[model samples]
Target: QSYIFYGPTMSPFTAYLIIRGISTLEIRIRQQEKNALKVAQFLENHPKVERVYFPGLDSHPQRDLVKKQMHGTGSVLSFVIKGGYAAGETMVNNVELVTLAVSLGCVESLIEHPASMTHSELSPEERKKSGINDSLIRLSVGLEDAEDIIDDLKRAFEKV
Candidate 1:
């Protein structure tokens, strides 16, 4: 004798969900890449940005190594504020569109105080040795229109 069980198969629904998520992820990732490149180019020469650390910039110190080791420059880059911590914190707070938050790899732009957020877990000496400081601001570029994002940054810098 043999026994047969009947139930709704979940494979089709699961496949659809997987495919849908992948498609959305691909689109957002492409947009984010384009946006990041544009923003990096903009900030590279901006007066307030002492240095833009995005690999896409030919002037970036590690551009050569980046070309050989990385698939993309990614959305995040750290820049030093002109006047140090006071100016950096002011810039972070003045931004309207960019959210002051931790983490990266999101569709929405985020700014974080690594010295107090990601590096806060480390002691002052450790943070200093690791090159994380109050004067540095890390930006996670988002999928927003490049011009609007730049405009927001310009406005924020003006306030800073």
Candidate 2:
């Protein structure tokens, strides 16, 4: 019963899994960053995207500082849709390949609407103050083929 209350140690299999993950961490991260940059570029030029918040993009306000401080821009990015909250929801709903989830930095692409999902508890004013607009959408780019990710987002954008 005491053992059940709190595990004395993690399983060997779990430890092995952790080690295996660490072994490929660098490779996976490189691929994820590459994919994220491609996706960010696409979103930056997309008509439906009001603004893309990826530091890798030349248009990003902090692009110079980001380049100075970071090797890669990172796998997660956020954007504001041209339409409002409903547009964000509709686009996310229409995605075929990207999964809708609040969790990020996984092996698979994930998308979320902060206003309605992660930061839903905040009042409109509070959300606005935090720069989480109604049309804001966050995406965690994965290791999937960049074209496929762009295609998936293109299809979703059409619905907005």
Candidate 3:
């Protein structure tokens, strides 16, 4: 597909890099998952967080299904801040360690606001139908120590 625009296929060196990544993928995922669960729990109990939506959490609506089919919950989560768009913007702006980025699934933590970022093109009704909100924030946990991530979040929360 579209091989001419890109290449006939991936170069040998790129394939080798992907193969190398595959070797440690599982370990990386597990560590990210662990960090995510901790981050989720912290958010769930925080006064500033209105709701947390990580499948690893006991409070997750699909917890039963998650347990049945998944060995571990992946490292991404979405949550609602107690305040709306302004608060979301403040927290993201204040982040010192976590990066405010649209790209995720990385070695470093990343955060984004779907209402204004990924789903910005959608109209109000469309956004409502898709469940994206002014306060909704997505976080992709990374390889950092869980405490460090929490501390970064706490600093951000103080601004909100």
Best model number under TM-score: 2
For 1-160, candidate 2 gives per-residue lDDT tens digits of 3555564688899999999999999999999999999999999988888999988889999989998999887899999998898998898889989999999989899999998898899998999999889999999999899899999999998878
Per-candidate TM-scores read: 0.81, 0.92, 0.90
Q: Which portions of model 3 miss their true places by more than 4 Å?
A: 1-7
Per-residue lDDT of candidate 1, residues 17-60 (tens digit): 97988879867877787888888888887898887778878888
Residues 16-100 of candidate 3 have per-residue lDDT tens digits of 9999999999999999999999999999999999999999999998999999999999999999998887888787878888999
TM-score of 3: 0.90
User: Which residue ranges in model 2 land beyond 4 Å of their true spot?
Assistant: 1-7
- Minimal lDDT window, size 10, model 3: 1-10
Provide the lDDT at 56 for model 3.
98
- Candidate 1 minimal-lDDT segment of 10 residues: 112-121
Relative to the true structure, how large is the alpha-carbon lDDT of every model?
A: 0.83, 0.92, 0.92
Candidate 1 segments exceeding 4 Å error: 1-18, 121-124
Candidate order by decreasing TM-score: 2, 3, 1
